[model samples]
Target: MNKALLMCLLILPGHAIALVIDSSKPIEISANMVVIDERKNISTYIGKASITQGSLILNAEIIQLFSNQQSVIKIIAKGTHKQLAHYQQNQPNQSRFIEARALNITYLIEQELVHLKGKAHLVQGFDSFSGGTLDYDIKNDKIITSMSKDGTQRVRFKIKL
Candidate 1:
């Protein structure tokens, strides 16, 4: 809730976006209700939760923060089928920003990884990716996607030169 507490929770090993300016900017979170459990080191935000910092923004119906020893270890955001959780961050010195959306999004800060499931979609500049599941390795700049087991959903990509 407080600035110091939010900053401490976000200053992890690898940032979601490698934006220098974004980190310097303050983080802002908005939601209908927030529940913090100090003993469990977990914080939950219910009802149209949104977090913003500089050019970065994340929105979901429910957002949960998991921390260990005052440092954030993981973050999970969930949304309904009609309105998927969304994440966006501006690229350094670029007009276009990277965007992602899914029914559920899991961010592993220390590992520098992001998992997107249920109608996952990611877009950067003019390139785009969509699938049933998407695993993004932030540190390695690699992405792995898969189709649904029932074969109803398939992987799709659109890249522009």
Candidate 2:
């Protein structure tokens, strides 16, 4: 019901997007510390932050929820350059789950878009994709990915039999 709760619900994208959000479900977040700035309408979680909604889980070094007076605006999860923020969602109807990892991950509440950057990796069912960045437009159900063109780095995708 509240913006902070909505932001936590979104860390689990599978339930938020694929299965459609069940807003009535409880959203939980755990971390070394959590701070909420009521004046700014922002919530920040630091140090091995973990957020869970239903069967979906997200882990990162920091998670920030930004909101306006009306509602949540954006949610960001950041990991150390050497480490990676991780998200996994289970889709019961599809009988499959999706997993993603990246140095930074952002979810735009207004557009329902997700962006992953810095050595991003995503896996859905038997297909896996790895690149420097990944963007998913949930509204359109479209995915766009790219990687550094230095020849040393290229987009990689795999589909297992």
Clashes of each: 0, 0
- lDDT score for candidate 1 against the true structure: 0.78
Model 2 vs truth, CA RMSD: 4.7
Candidates' C-alpha lDDT: 0.78, 0.73
Candidate 2's residue-wise lDDT over 19-93, tens digit each? 344334556778887777777777889999987766657789998877765556777899887779997766443
Give me the runs in candidate 2 sitting further than 4 Å from their true place: 1-21, 91-94, 149-152
Model 2: per-residue Cα lDDT at residue 80: 85
Provide the TM-score for each candidate, comma-separated. Answer: 0.84, 0.77
lDDT of residue 98 for candidate 2? 70
Model 2's TM-score against the true structure: 0.77
lDDT of 1 by residue, 1-161 (tens): 68635643554323433356676676677888878776787778889998787887889999887877646678899999989999887765445887889999998867868899999999868888989999877667677999977777799999899
